[model samples]
Target: MMVKPLATNRSSSGMSTGKLAVWWLIASEIVIFGGVLASYLMFRLGHPEWGAAASHTNTWAGALNTMVLLTSSLSAVLAHQAAEQGDGKKAARFLYFTVLGALMFLVIKSFEWTHEIGLGFTLQSGGFWSFYYLAAGIHAAHVIAGAIIMIWVAAYAKRNEELQRVEYIGIYWHFVDIVWIFLFPLLYIAK
Candidate 1:
């Protein structure tokens, strides 16, 4: 008996199936974040006092994390480039750098949060604190998830298997960074 080979489905939109799926995931994330941000903006406008609470946020820490994430994004882009060139080891190295950046960002965030909580800026402190925790917490979770995924991709990249995944992971990392870009300004610089 002969078996038929499975066929790959091409995207009608001219995108790779993997890339298209990533875009769809990002679109959904945008809606979730947009709703939260819109609600925060509405409440912030109605309760101007929220600005006073926001002022207490560590601007320096936020700025540092911004730089870290941006650097990580550059590494992710480089990983994709290396993967395209079929340099699996080089691609894996870049991915490791990206993961390191994520760790640095998380560390800075934890310190900032600890200081704020010590100063009585707990979630139950007020509406502003609640929103602050919710938004940043979700973003951190994404960062953690991205780092783990990158690590997995890096392992495969080193073996030259599934190299296309490097690009997909890069796309996801960029989205994560962009989210932080919006969040840093809103949470730390808006005051």
Candidate 2:
């Protein structure tokens, strides 16, 4: 007979394994974003001229994207709640709304980037543009990743009845939003 090992929920330190794992992941992410933002601040401080360069970015677009992300966070929370209630269908619906928000965010971002580049604001324009592209581009990538995760979570909820993970994914999705909350002010409104 083949023996199946039991998967325990408690870690060696007596912490809930899932929560500990999520916290570890979040801690690593903080290191990554923190390093990037610190470097950006250092550069911005050293080069006082970057202020005028920062002003060229569209504030309205940044504000709109912030709203989109905030709304997505709300949808993610709703999805998690539905999952907790064992309503897979409702969970899927809320997840779909979250995905739609990501799509909207990307569309707006695309237009904003194209318009800015058309106005001669390429990455080569200056150090500020470089950082702008780097920061926004990374945030957009995270948005894409979150959307993909949402789709998978929704599908799993539909067939596997595994809605408990909704909360985990929601936490990650909210982290992405929180990053944007800081990025918006640093890149768009700081100047």
- Tens digit of lDDT per residue, candidate 2, span 1-191? 95434343445766555656767887888898888889999999899999999989889999999999999999999998888888888999999999999999999999999999999999899999999998888889989988998899899887646676787788889999999999999999978
Cα displacement (Å) at residue 147, model 1: 0.3
Q: By TM-score, how accurate is candidate 1?
A: 0.94
- What clash count goes with each model? 0, 0
Compute the lDDT of residue 139 as modeled in candidate 2.
81
| lDDT of candidates 1 onward, in order | 0.93, 0.88
TM-score of each: 0.94, 0.91
Instruction: Output the worst ten-in-a-row residue range by lDDT, candidate 2.
Output: 2-11
Which residue pairs of candidate 1 clash? none
**Global lDDT for candidate 2?**
0.88
Q: For residues 90-137, could you state the per-residue lDDT of candidate 1 as single tens digits?
A: 999999999999999999999999999999899999999999999999
Q: After superposition, which runs of candidate 1 have C-alpha atoms over 4 Å from their true positions?
A: 1-9
